[model samples]
Target: MRFISEQRFDNGCLEREFTLGDIPGILWTPSSSPSPLILLGHPGGMNTMYPRLASRARRCAQNGIAAATIELPGRGERPRSAGAERARADLRRALAAGEPVDEIVDRLVIPLVDRAVPEWRSALDALLSLPDVRGPVGYSGGLIALGIRLAVIEPRIAAAGLFAGSFVPRCMFHEARRITIPLHVLLQWDDEANDRQSALDLFDAFGSREKTLHANMGGHMGVPEFAGDDAARFFARHLT
Candidate 1:
């Protein structure tokens, strides 16, 4: 990891930005001591610097936990391609039309996950190499597909807090069955962009004996502040 810049907040939290090869990322560490790390995954169209992600990192730091996030494929400073743009457009159209998106998801979302999951693993390796980060790692946020894949494959992640307000491809259901880590899933009861049944199905598909679903009645962005607090407590219990 190559250090790019850093800023220290008045609360004694240190935030640093870096690049792992070509991937841009940020790490937040509390002032007192080394803490367990959480790998935050941003919502679609957002980067590591998205306010929610940054706020979550700060919240984790306040709770004596370190956090890190990397920009997903086709995001941040990564090079964009015409094929990616077209795939995104097709996904949007498919979602808006309420059509079967299996083909589009297979073509687009799977490839994105294929590239992203390994990068997340690589980022985990680099983040943990830092002096102030410890083991018993956790993962939080979305895109849900990437979260599902990571939960299935990344043994380093002891727990996961996933947002279930995105489109779920059929294959992801199978992947969810393989996720045996402790899971805390958040779902919006009336999320405009997501199929409620699909989200419920995905949550039910998780094979973790310790999985919990926190469903709230609101739109896609209606996850309240307390929801984050609850997730933090969950991570504290598992990661710490």
Candidate 2:
């Protein structure tokens, strides 16, 4: 309803703070009915207000849902934290001090995946603190989305909407299977992040009673206007 305010939460290692929008986002309910929330996480190079995310936020607002957009550390106004690059280097070193096969994927294989969960949880917490906040919430994006889903499986999040992302299903599959939340996945025909097969793999792994897969005929950023409306409809059915 009103611009609550914005605050910065550190990644625990960085002095530069990450910004979160608490005001002027999408809000459909009266801020008391416990509606589902939509939290956005941008790609490494993008921010919360990018066209794709902004458009969806507006649509969600029009449809009577609250929407918040988020940015990862160093991607928005901040730069990489001191020793962030070095910490990544150390993780690589630790992972490398093992067998050759495991060493190849090594540090990035798990630590990076492991680190993202908390960030999403923190963002969700911030979004839910508003007046009419509700239980079921969802996320969209690449590693950020996958990592968050991997961490917590709350049935309150009655549904999830994913676009162009997947995770290590083998390691995350058991937890992933626990997700009874309906899933709506969107993928571009020419997505370089793998292919439609990647989205299919995630969908099949989830085994939700309800699921929808859409293949749009566009490049990475060319999601149709219909997708936003579809997302609103899906969340409304499950969240409300």
Candidate 3:
């Protein structure tokens, strides 16, 4: 896996191409006048540049939101067979640590996510520093986003969108109430990676005065069902 190339877009934003563990994805700045900064995450074994997150970023940019997706250290341009093996080992450790096999992806992946936050924050700073840029931070996938919400103790986040994500860092659940910013969650009705109960638990935890939960009748990998106008609406409410 490698970063194939980069392209500059309409607003002096750069679009870069990357090869994930298998697939290809683009990291770009939408041509919107004033864009929001979004940090996209992929499901376990999936690429951050996956369409699930890319399409969402594209939509946000089209709707005047500036977005960017950072590839995870081992899964994107720096993929390795050993990386997959390491992920499996982490999963086992998470289970032994009392985290359910199902939740291992959310719990054990924390260290990887912790390592990725600085990269994400740097990317966020670059995107937000652009003129007229002032969008909230949002995330997809499960572990990475929750990790950002947990590990990074910054107050600049205006809003967050967690799609098919979980609630970890047991200590941070109460902080959800303090976020004050609007939060929107998209939970697939038939998810295999993260269960519905987990989503409900997260919803119950976020209890934001302004929160929206959208349900899609699809599996964990099924992303389009949760895309389109609703995503724009979520970013609009939070970013715009």
Name the best candidate (by lDDT).
1
lDDT of 2 by residue, 1-240 (tens): 234444321211101123444212333233234556766555544445456665565555555565565445544454565444555466457546642322323333345445445555556666577556665666555452453354245333456777754334345545556566677777777864444664566667666678787778767666777876676687788766
Top-scoring candidate (TM-score): 1
Clash-forming residue pairs, model 3: 35-66, 36-66, 36-135
TM-scores of the candidates in the order shown? 0.95, 0.66, 0.71
Q: Candidate 1 — which residues are off by over 4 angstroms?
A: 44-49
Rank by lDDT (best first): 1, 3, 2
Please, what are the lDDT tens digits per residue for candidate 1 over residues 81-179?
567779779988987888887787777777888889999999999888888897778888868888888888888889999988776679779889999
Per-candidate Cα lDDT values, in order, are: 0.85, 0.53, 0.59
Clashes of 1: 0
Ranking by TM-score: 1, 3, 2
Clashing pairs in 1: none
Please write out the lDDT profile of model 3 over residues 1-240, one tens digit for every residue.
Answer: 346897774545556665544445456566655656666655443353355555566666666666555555566445555644565687767656766664445444555656566666666565566565666666544553443353235566666667754435444456555555566677878876565786676677774578778878768767564364676677677666
